[model samples]
Target chain A: MNAAVTATRGATALDIAAIRRDFPILHQSVNGKPLVYLDNAASSQRPKSVIEAVSRYYEHDHANVHRGVHTLSQRATDAYEGARETIRRFINARDTKEIVFTRGTTEAVNLVAQSFARPGFQPGDEILISALEHHANIVPWQLLREQVGAVLKVIPISEQGEVDFVEFEKLIGPRTRLLALAHVSNALGTIVPVEKFIKVAKQHGVPVLLDGAQAIPHTPVDVQALGCDFYCFSSHKMLGPTGMGVLYGRKELLEAMPPWQGGGDMILSVSFEKTTFNQLPWKFEAGTPHIAGAIGLAAAIDYLETIGMERIAAYEHELLEYATDRLSRVPGLRIVGTAANKAAVVSFTLEGIHPHDIGTILDTEGVAIRTGHHCAMPVMEFFNIPATARASMSFYNTREEIDRLAAALEHTRKVLG
Target chain B: MDLKDLYRDVIVDHNRHPRNFGKLEPADVHADGHNPLCGDRLTMYANLEGEHIKDVKFEGSGCAISVASASLLTEAVKGKSKSEVKELFDDVHALLTQHDAAVDPARLGKLAALSGVREFPARVKCASLCWHTLNAALDRAAEPVSTE
Candidate 1:
């Protein structure tokens, strides 16, 4: 395959300087030095459009959405519903009803655990999740296992951090009710072959819920093409506002499942004796939602749309390669995940030196990085390390920033030694 | 002088050549403490002479702050009574946590070098996890000796 093929007519480099200008926080200092914010996996810094959209909603369109006869209500409802449509188009979902807004990815997973998995789960029914899952993906299924007598099966990964497909296939049986996995690993940055995995799960008559929390921000995601039953992702991780997230479920599946929560907006009618439920989306979105959050997310989607996801992904891929090569040359340094298909996250450990020490020294030089298990303790256990120093990147990250990181790591080795 | 003045040559020397940094066989008390937040792990062994800590040895993985703090702690507690060690630990902890830059320097000894850590609040765990675990180990021994 021509891996180094020239860009096609449609392919263009992302204007990062122009893009960087959209995000105000990118220009700042930390620890008396310029901040190189590489911790995008934890959460992304919001663009000005997203930030302004949120403020605008609260300033101008501040009212309860859905069923208000007033103009402000209609305006608020339009903005909120408009945000839903933006995400629906972004993920390429079939209908707006499939995109149910939730607090974030954690709530989205819990919604599925409570509404879908909890009701049908029985003894011998297995829930297969990868070793690279964040605690959000792990704990909800654990709670469901305790509640519904379901068994939690782990899909192991190779030392290089790619999910062991053969082992994953072996774990999948007729008993597997669900295959919940991160689309892109929060710790390792291994972008799993999710579309293929979804197809395999479908063959087994099992549903797949992708934790697209990391994937959506970095790459293009199409629910229709992936053919997954559900996809969940947090807006905050995608340069949007914090409190909002999207859960894309197949319409038939969502309609069949009972509502996870009961409140005003979710119900069609209620009496002391009985209660009736509303339609999809609203049925899942109970009470007053994060109005400004939805507005902000829509603006974030617009920002990504303007830049183009493919260009962003390609740029980040280049940055990842540059960073990997740079970090690999450092003596006594070992890269944790070397999966062929990965995002821009590079997790590594220095020989005989603790990650905390690495993080502290780097911070002293004005480079901020995340150091620890990264909330994926199983991945840490897999590597047999207590923790790792992770430098996650986004479209904003540059090769120069990566050089800064490399220089800081070298300085750390000298200082700590 | 600012707290950065606290990172004196003495502190760096102790951090580089940590005192009593080895395992004690047949140790009277052995305990391990980990700061899960930062992933610093420390294992400490103490040979008790009745209520007094005859010897305290430490081995683990951590940042310079934690290793240095542990080294300073070992030096301060040697030859002191168990009660004196407890009192000294309290005094050192209070000194580190104090917001006032004018904390009396006489009480902290070489441990005073960590006053710089207070400026970087995030590293407080790196500086204190070992000390907190030492207190836990001592309390667990419970021969009229409270570690905290």
Candidate 2:
């Protein structure tokens, strides 16, 4: 078979119209107009395959995994573990043993903070993170700091929303124990130069954890290549089901850390006095787990792989450029987060208009965008704004939708001005 | 529901140029109000002479509905007895929230504009944030009130 031809707009090999058809939610109307969903950064619309896979799991293979000797239980166990292998390949991790499943990215981060980092933390030890982190990354470290008397140090961001690399290098001192940072910022869409930071942390003998919830969907992630000791991401943000996420840790690191929670499946044998913990991945997962969610996530990974990640990234870059150009022309509109390297998210504010009003007006025009602090309150504090209206794109989103967003924003100005 | 119903002309006008939109010095009581969902924040201040409201003002940043509602609330509550302000607050609350509650527009006057917020269920908190703060200030409560 011949290689797929790349589209004229960058290296995207996707047929936008064909891809839009795969998502069933895209065909509906909201408030008498065709839905223009630019809220993919919040949660992406799942394809039919993912939805079907989830339903298929519940319909045919609904059974407790690794508990019974029945055919259904074995099938469930096979599918669930098969998903772990798929995730391992997707991120190019060394082994499936490093992969752990949790409720989502929040739980994954909390688990690492509580289990791995907390034990080794000492009073006055510094935990370094960026200013652009979501509350999920910040709060967990703050809680850990409060418990262990550790100090949380933030690497300040630049005026353009990018993390200050020079300041970051200066903040890494002898007392710095761990470095946790967002691979991609949810609020500003700024892709952090994590590889360079990871190299610096490695020089200091500090392990790094990357919050990949916002990165994995937009770009290709290779944990082995990134050299991050821990990486966590959410499935819901990547067109998979909610309540399922992946936590990838280096093999040696995970082996050294004690189990986070103790319960049914995370144990090898349970005696009254001494309970032996299960090995590797199973040791991290303690409960019945979201078995169907794992299957659906595997289907999502298959879908994303079918359409290459590089193509999707390129297509979304084009969309972001188109949106930025169109929105820039609107009078009195200020685009926030104009980082040199960024993702497909555009956050902005119109003069004399609150983001809440903008959101309300946009919804009337069938344009769905997120208008809030985006769970990144510190980012808002840095900008000195209450909130911003963010329109984030996916590969399936069209240029016409960007135009609609601009028009709707113009309408908002007219109504509110 | 129509967007116009929620964002009436009067509401828009009030948002553009809010009345009593500043700090009142030597104020007897003041309370801050925050709507965490949308990040709408305002502080309500009142100078009371015994049981009578001598003056009231608010200062903060928020959405159009919230600022407009606060402006209208300050205008309606100034120079009234504490009991009268309390009664007006109840009436305005009923007007903005109760779907089928009978309300006379002429009696409500400028405050009637906020009745449109009832259509947009999510914005009810935006319209009520200032009123809740005002109530807190009247009761001389020290803690900030939050419309979570």
Best by TM-score: 2
Q: Where is model 2 more than 4 Å wrong at Cα?
A: A1-10, B141-148
lDDT of 1 by residue, A1-417 (tens): 122122322455665666777779978776676777888988899988888888888888889999789999999999999999998999999999999999999999999999999988888799999999999999999999999899999989998999988898899998999999999999999999987788889889999999999999999999999999989999999989898898899999999999988988999999999999999989998889998888899999999998889888988898898899999998889999999999999999987667877876777666778899999998998998889999999888777778889988887767655
User: Which runs in model 1 stand beyond 4 Å of their true positions?
Assistant: A1-10, B1-16, B101-104, B143-148
Cα lDDT of model 2 by residue, A1-417, tens digit = 011112445356577767877899998889998898999999998999999999999999989999989999999999999999999999999999999998899999999999998998899999999999999999999999999999999999998999999999999999999999999999999999899999999999999999999999999999999999999999999999999999999999999899999899999999999999999999999988999989999999999999989888888888888888999999999999999889999999899999999998999999999999999999998999999999999888887888889999999998988
Classify candidate 1 by CAPRI docking class: acceptable
DockQ of 1: 0.43
TM-score for each of the candidates: 0.94, 0.97
DockQ scores for all predicted structures: 0.43, 0.73
Which window of ten consecutive residues has the lowest lDDT sum in model 1 chain B?
B1-10
Error of 2 at A215 (Å): 0.5
lDDT per residue for candidate 2 within B29-107, as digits (tens), equals 9999998768899999988776788889999999999999999988888878878877787888898889986877787
What is the interface root-mean-square deviation of candidate 1? 3.7
Tens-digit per-residue lDDT, B1-148, candidate 1: 2223434566556668889898888787778989877767888788788778888889887766788888888877766677887787677766677776465678667777777776667777777777778777888788565659
